[model samples]
Target: MEQKKRKSSATIASIETEYVRSLQKKASRKHARKIRLYRRLTVFAVVAAIILVGMTQMYMKQKQVLEAKELEKMEKTAQLEEVQQEQEALNRQLIKLDDDDYIAKLARKDYFLSENNEIIFSIPENKKKTDKKDNGKE
Candidate 1:
């Protein structure tokens, strides 16, 4: 069986004394103070979280920039080394070109030029290839 409860249509009166009023005011003030304290703490926590995130983002950006700079520096250093090596090779070639004997030998080989009393013999490319092969076999 289910029972239905009826509401009482009656009004209750509270004691209206100075001591009761003072106690109620004190209780309300304490509740208000607690609310204010909680609000302040929430604001502080939010600000601190924002500051921490900002610092972390800044640190990550700086780290990425530093890594990129180091990579660029390494690439530039490699390029500089290659350029230095090429310069050294050119310097050696220049020194060799300054020698008269080397220049004469280069000219004779490339231009088929001969010195006085020296007969220039023109060998066929096919004969030279065959000679190289025979030498290798030996």
Candidate 2:
């Protein structure tokens, strides 16, 4: 009966040791899982940061290109407006040239022409001579 009692005590001690070892193993596994989770989260954050920076740079570049195009459009619009004004002036001049009176006036003024049996007398502008005499008197 004493031998049976010693054998039972030894069995209980071995079972207790086995239970402690299993608890230690489970703690180690939990620690390892925590480390792996931290590493995965860190890697994901770095990749996300890189992607965000790249997208911002691309957006700025596209904005600059769009602004340049808009400026060019404005310049072209101004140039077109100027050309349209010049074309309108030329059209009015062309219409004026179709009138006989305007043609006669242009010829008489620019070419010194006169009608048949009409005499032309030439007169110099008196304002310049008068201004010169006035200055001399002063």
Candidate 3:
């Protein structure tokens, strides 16, 4: 009975040692897998940070370029308005030229003409001293 008890005790001790060794190996494997996953996640996070910075820089540059284009467009619009005002002024002058009284007065001052065959009278009191260049003939 003593030898049987000793043999059984040895067998139980061996089984316990084997089970503890197995559990240690499985835990080490799980810890190694966790370390590998942590490395992959760290690499992914770094890549995402770099990409985010690059995209933000690109957005700022594009926004500046668009703002410059908008300013240029506004300048061009102001120039167009000035040209339009000049064109309207010329149109008004053209309308004045089309008036019969204005044209007839211009013709009488530019060319000697009379409604009837009347003699030309030069009144010294009505005549003011002027040069030929001042009259725009030179």
Candidate 4:
């Protein structure tokens, strides 16, 4: 009777130990799953942060490009003003084309025409100096 009682108690203790080990294993699995979920969340957060920074940089770069384009437009506007001034001067020169003295000068210089009794002497400047360079090989 005593041996039977001891055997029953020993079997109950072994069952309790097995149940405790199983519970511990389940708890460890739960903790591991939580850790894995946290790691995934961390990775997602990092990716999101990087994308935000990249978008900000792209926006800033585009802004800089737009500002440069605007500055170029301003420079072009200034250049246009200078060109307008030159155009006005050219228009004044055109208005003078009907003058008889100017027409005579143009005919003499461009068409090489002169009055009947005038003696025309032509002297051409040498053009060789315009083609010279300091290169030793050439």
Off by over 4 Å in 1: 1-20, 117-138
lDDT value for model 2: 0.94
lDDT of each: 0.93, 0.94, 0.85, 0.88
Find the candidate with the highest TM-score and give its number: 1
Report the CA-based lDDT of candidate 4 relative to the real structure. 0.88
Counted clashes in each candidate structure: 0, 0, 0, 0
Q: In candidate 4, which residue pairs clash?
A: none
In candidate 4, stretches whose alpha carbon ends up further than 4 angstroms from where it belongs are: 1-28, 101-138
Which digits, one per residue and each the tens of the lDDT, describe model 1 over residues 1-138? 122222222344568999999999999999999999999999999999999999999999999999999999999999999999999999999999999999999989889999999888889999999999999999
Q: What tens digits encode model 2's per-residue C-alpha lDDT throughout 1-138?
A: 999998998888544688899998999999999999999999999999999999999999999999999999999999999999999999999999999999999998878899999887766769778878999999
lDDT, ranked from best to worst: 2, 1, 4, 3
List candidate 2 stretches off by more than 4 Å.
Answer: 1-16, 108-114, 117-138
Positional deviation of residue 1's Cα in model 4 after best superposition, in angstroms: 41
Per-residue lDDT tens digits for candidate 4, residues 45-134, read: 999999999999999999999999999999999999999999999999898896989989998987788988987776554433443543
RMSD of 4: 10.0
- TM-score-superior candidate, 3 or 4: 3
Q: Relative to the unseen true structure, what is the C-alpha lDDT of residue 103 in candidate 3, on a scale of 0 to 100?
A: 84
Best by lDDT: 2
